[model samples]
Target chain A: MKYINHEELLKMEPQYRVQVINSLSGFKSANLIGTRDENNINNLAIFSSVFHLGASPALVGFISRPDSVDRHTLRNIQQIGQFTINQVNADFWQAAHQTSARYSDGECEFKQTGLTPHFIDNSDAPFVKESQLKYALKLNEIVPIRLNNTLLVIGEITDILCDKAAIKADGYIDIESLNTVMVSGLDSYHTSKRLSRLSYAKPGILPTKISLDGKS
Target chain B: MKYINHEELLKMEPQYRVQVINSLSGFKSANLIGTRDENNINNLAIFSSVFHLGASPALVGFISRPDSVDRHTLRNIQQIGQFTINQVNADFWQAAHQTSARYSDGECEFKQTGLTPHFIDNSDAPFVKESQLKYALKLNEIVPIRLNNTLLVIGEITDILCDKAAIKADGYIDIESLNTVMVSGLDSYHTSKRLSRLSYAKPGILPTKISLDGKS
Candidate 1:
């Protein structure tokens, strides 16, 4: 086994530390967040920090890097109060990854990456057409982390669009069927195979694997 | 494609809605958070909301359910300011998942779930012996999300222990090598296969897949 203490971690090279610390948390959800500026110039960026915030209000949140430089996604969400989250699948993982590159404020990552800007039923934000699962969100709140200067942007799920076949009776969307990619750290991509979906856990009961056919 | 609007989503059954909305963001990291109360009573809980907050200071954050209920994890962190996050592997995921059950205060989930509590360097918190990757964190800050009533507890990484074989030369941990299982929604566990690790993305350079042999 290997061990790294706080002092040693702090002394590590900046980029090396970033890669280590980011990957330390394990796998992260990979998604492309799309927004449009006031002039409607579309912007897309890949974010792995997106996490489920709540369910009743269908809320989701993602951390935005420190606002030291221009952040088109945060600016657009603030201005329009709307954005879209598209799952990064194998088909567009590279293009989606490319969105992370520092592009100018006015530039459209969709055009640069060759991924289509998809408009779904008057959504103010664009969705990745290549994405099998996508949804639109309206900004609900922005909480600032004073420790790091990063903003945790919470949003209410406004609309969800997905292939009907991917949804199970219990509402689990089969991500593996969609080839949705999961990321470790900042650069590694992975495709997962569902090991099992266990039944709701209880105190003394051993969980039984739920069948993929939506039956116990 | 199937589309679910906000109104329809709001009207769905509560548990069903939770399942749907939780899985909507895609796969999430599965980890067991271990903490000890003032009485030295160990508490362990499964958390999927943990996300990387920053890398420079090695910070991580996870959402805690509204404080309306007694949260041992939050209370313990507030009291001791230290906790351990152990990655849930396929071997102990069920035991890890069982920690989610509503347990009375002072009851040790580590004992109840049949997971061993291993201490290292006289750390205050326990780490799951079955976990291949585990780390300790010191509570840094807790930011409350007013919109959702959830608290984002941020912690600075202090010490990390992992199998030497799991880390790559570039600092990315090979989660697949460790067989760390990812979770979807609330219960489904998954094992991932590396699709490819691409080099750092730049403006126009095509990403080349980096070799796993610790070389470019």
Candidate 2:
């Protein structure tokens, strides 16, 4: 493999680089933003850049660049103090895509794209009216990355909203029943489906047997 | 969206939890791990559990259960003081999967899987022989997640090793071209391909332009 420096790495142009990141974050499906009118005026768009930060506080974040001036999503998050991460399902991929358009600062994506906005109960945050899963994050910290203009927006998962019925008794999130959109970088969409559930194990260890068929 | 409790969330098993995490970590794309193995017990494994921790020290980590009864990969890092992270690609997925096998404590996954092992000048941790990108990581604090028996293995990424050709001029890693596999949930896999890349902005903000055309 060829090891390149930052100078050489940054020479690839915006479009090419975005494609690579998009591939990393895109492909699976789509998602939409669920923000309040006041905040939507600040202008927020959702990209597949969104990813799970950790489970302790149930943190999640997405990468965003400046509106055009090239500020950074971390900046807006700092201003907002709180932001809602709404899961995109098949139902809202298109509307979510529309939100991606660089709209004016004062524009309301909900009205323009027709995705309904629902205020969450636990927090004073707006949510995707139809999103089956939503998260209210209290901005924790915005960590910049090694790569050129990228930043990791970390947050404290203050509140989690989900379609409880979709959550399995065993704690499995049954997004498959809801058929939500799974996104990669961009231009791709997927539905939630179960393939095979692997049995748990530690490396080089055998699971204890409760009973050997006929032998106790 | 329905909100569930921590008890209900914890009830979910690790097997299922891992899959959910894989999906969340950009669905398990390959990354490069590079280090020297002074112990001579070359350890190389592809983890969908691997993720970008705080980028400040350029940290990244992957969670692994004990190799055997009480053998822990984390413990190895703690004792050895170093390790490498290798990004997975189509070229090495099959071989990488083999490393996931529960090998005996003394066994080298590189030998057991027949995957080549390579090392760099700086460290003693061996990297996956076929990974296109690799990194040298110094052991950092390990935080045990409050959940069942899982751990948040944290490492500080000190140096990066990559194939310059795979890196784009825009600081983007063209992982799809590198043929990396993305994981969702436990066993599901998604092959990455070029999609769309967009700048970050609030919803309905102007100056929206897609960076990548159809082809990258």
Best by TM-score: 1
Return the clash pairs for model 1, or none. none
* Chain B TM, per prediction: 0.95, 0.78
Q: Comparing to the true complex, what docking class would candidate 1 get?
A: high
lDDT (Cα, tens digit) per residue for candidate 2, span B61-180 = 555445232243565677788877776665655555556566665777677656687776667787676766666677776654333344546676554566667555445555555565
Give the TM-scores of the predictions, in the order they appear.
Answer: 0.97, 0.63
CAPRI tier for the interface of model 2 = incorrect
Q: Taking the tens digit of each residue's C-alpha lDDT, what string does model 1 give over B1-216?
A: 898987899899997788889888889999889999999999899999888989988899998985522289999999999999999998888888788887788678988889999888837998888899999998999888877688889999999999999888878788889999999877889999888888777777766788864356
